[model samples]
Target: MAIEVASLPLPASADPSKFVDFGKEVKGIDPGNLTDDQFKEIQELLYKHDALLFRDCSLSPEQQYALTKRFDPASENYGHGNNKTGSTVKSILHPDLKTIPRVPQVQLIGNGTVYNHEGLATANLKHPSHTTFHKTQVSQIDEDAGITRYYRWHIDAALYDLSPPKVTTLYGIHVPHGKRQTIRYDDGTGDELEVPLGTTAFVSGKTMFDLLSPELKSLAVRTKVKYAPHPYVWMAPARAMPTGLGIESEGRELPLEELPPWEESKLKVLPVLWKNPVTGNLHFQVHPCGVMELLVEPLPQGAKREGALYPDGAHLTDIKEVRELLYKMQRPAIAPSLVYPHDWKEKDLVLFHNRGVLHSVVGAFTKEQVRAFHQCNLAASDDPTGPTADDIKKYA
Candidate 1:
């Protein structure tokens, strides 16, 4: 039987035209047990759409891992590595995940304590909130009044040793429902979005690249980003901007000397844009919070240089300068009209292309409001493909 697929429901605020092929809700197939042809067709759909949702699935950690591994057969370790976050106590991610003992590659994430769950006798999960990470947060009064903020906008990657996962699978085992909260951008533009509590907000990296001005596009294709070694630990002392788009430019980042022993050789220097393997589309895929430097190549020879950002090429060492430029390029694509905040239900399985879109955990949950989810993503066997020579020449 042919798979049943339909476009996801977009908010009225979203520009429908831009999301004509962005996300899809696929029904009538059990993802954990797909035939080879079914898996192949699903793979094609996932790349073209970027995010796929399968509702009412009965998936286990073993099944989730199997489904995720099909995307990268050679990969078996978790995206952050098996139990790496638990051991990296200084990392900002330490509090958010609990590895399932039997299925170490699948993590049990979400709020409140879970007992006897998939080989875990007891798991205490904390829902990540802007209050703990953001420099400034809505007051308790405001929070009680239903105001919230985006916890962080990022791709699912360790950004240290492992290559970013190509896809991430999140299965909601227990979903908590509540009134929608208003997301205040708090970046001084007075932006706000009404989203369901704990919704996962997503924005297209393709759209992020597409929205850039010609000059920024020229810069994006020519630039590469250098991530801090042990980035999560490096940024633990830092604070985030009000928008949660990137780090606040304070001198609070941990010094390289203070971070967990890291080698210069292990530091990541990756392209600012990742090329989609199947579709050949370029996605503006930088992790703004972890970036430490920008290595910009000069405009390609014989290409248009008028109004080019770095016609002579430059290595930007100033953290503030690098962050400002990235913010200017990325923030616009996450406006209220461009974001897709999925209202999740129990048994919902969302598969998103980690390289093609940026996503965030949107709100907080009270202790009593338990949310249990099985999250799985494998560190890819290889790094994401950057633009081809033809891509550079065309964009430049």
Candidate 2:
């Protein structure tokens, strides 16, 4: 508790490295009126500012679960388990919680859920009576040119073997206020390039390892990338539909394939560069649709994977060309000048760093705009926090 950094409180706008605004000197901000040295100055400025917006704050889901357990480092189990996904849609109304708390760490995202009809948004929808499983109904149906893939860039499960969410608070009950949508892409020489639509976006793995090139940062700190969660993810430009971003544990609707064999043998072997123990720098977690392989762990035994983005290096036996050369070495750190898209404001209170930010879910809200959001996650150590598929045996 010695985080006395000059008695904190000086961020009414420090867009220096993008994001740090306690919303014009705090007014509507209330985590029961923060003070414990402002939750260790907001967990040491999100361990070196990856993103932290506060705007007109108006919490009280128990004060957003006691200010997210004061920047929880697993605050006596923050959450990742206890299988969530119980909100068929009563239009979630959280002014100070009249009802909505089975406590899985508060989660009730929007798009007016009811994923597939049941009646006037299922009057007072609240079906969660101590589990019984089997209620499937979170459809996407189909979309690609019109988008609705529900979006996802990912970093949450980071493959999953555990220790994924360090912090990822989000609170902004109901947003999406009209006019703004013009996304397009593919300009490699064939027209079409609009973009503008990056709502809950973020991607800055320490600037993707400071825009690598020290021989691709020594083959990304001697590679270790290997994942296994893709049973289906067709949401690309022309591939258009099939998605999977809301992997609702075991009962919230979202799993389709892959992840069974003891949770895919717990495959998550990360390390395509690492070091961010709260801003030590260097991050490039990699997630080209949940990677499948690439373990050239030889940085000095016979090194030569040609330094990322293949010519003949990042090869894990061609799983679609190592997933398009790791999404073209991670598309310039998910571009848009190192993505940080979060314009939400209805009572904003974002706080990211889920292992170095890599979010998704950007636009499309209209049914008379009612966007809702109230998530929570924490993990630094306390792995294996539920959410499985159970059909493992991956990557050979």
Candidate 3:
């Protein structure tokens, strides 16, 4: 089936009182003093912006959990056992510190120069744990040496090899001076982009999934790794460090410890196309992690090639071409209209639909500043078009 891309609607310039009644209920929320119309107005704002930020929320951990429940009834309050014990409630400092705790459900990312330097907050809703396969660090940029470089652009939750995550949220605890720029662009469009602090945008998951080819799908399926579905799946050219890296084939596990050093520098890409089981909307997301190469072509039969191990097989694009394409994609010229930027602030609580939008963190911030936030994921079995319980049980 051919997919049709939807145009993003621009934000309306209206007085706050014009749209909000403040008396209506917002789906599953009960703010006590808020009226049904007021709640509906908030819902409309979130749908329009893909994310909503609240200043001075002053929510306790329990209150945070309650707010999350308004969006996802099955949301959890704390990180799971797979998460590192000390790392969950407390923070971990960087600089030659190895063996940091891994949270099964949540992930800690960023230039880990200090305990609280612009770190990332991530949670795996599909599968939660106390430990994560990926580690957090600042290897890409050497601070003591005064070297500052951004990581490649890609999506999160690509490592699981399963379907990409539907949604993700980032809350800001601190925003430092001279560190207020993060960049993003739309697919196949080389538009330069910028996202200021305290704003959030909804990315389309379908756009990200559409980049996959039949060969890549086969690889993902054969390996049962989840993301690719099979080895035959292929993707368009994208940017990253070193040569292009494909899933190779199914049936092989790329252990974290055994991967090449440069693999850590690669941006992670997910299947760009997806069908929303409920509202039936399409979403596109560009995740940043472990992405190697973008454009790929099948080799001719009986052809001898440098990286080719078999005749009539698939091969990755040349490193130079891949790098050029990546730089072009990274240029701010191709920014997506769907993205909404946010300003970072303390005591802010934001929420959005993961399956419905794509999101990224803004970089170019100083490490001396602290940015912290807590997150939880919600699971729902009531997907309108998802597999039936019997089918899921049979597959299990």
Clash count per candidate: 0, 12, 98
In the range 25-69, model 3's lDDT, one tens digit per residue, is: 123333323455665555455444344545455544344444444
lDDT of 1 by residue, 287-308 (tens): 8999999999988889887888
- By lDDT rank, best first, the candidates go 1, 2, 3
Worst lDDT 10-window in candidate 1:
259-268
- Which of the two, 1 or 3, has more lDDT? 1
lDDT at residue 388 of model 2 (Cα atoms): 13
Clashing pairs in 1: none
Write down the TM-score of every candidate: 0.99, 0.30, 0.46
* Candidate 1 segments exceeding 4 Å error: none
Best by TM-score: 1
Report the lDDT tens digits of candidate 2 across residue range 1-396.
232222113222213353332112223335456788676666667767656667677676567766766665346333433332232121111211112445555556665443322112331222111011112222233222333222446665434545566677788766756544432223232222123332565666667666756665555555666665422221111121122222222222123342233356765666665555654665666655555568754444334544433324445855565665555566555544345455676887877766666776654544444455677764446432211112001100
Better of 2 and 3 by TM-score: 3
| Model 2 regions more than 4 Å off | 1-40, 43-45, 48-150, 155-173, 176-221, 224-236, 240-271, 277-284, 287-321, 324-346, 362-366, 370-396
lDDT of each: 0.93, 0.48, 0.33
Q: Rank the candidates by TM-score, best first.
A: 1, 3, 2
Give per-residue lDDT, candidate 1, residue 254.
93
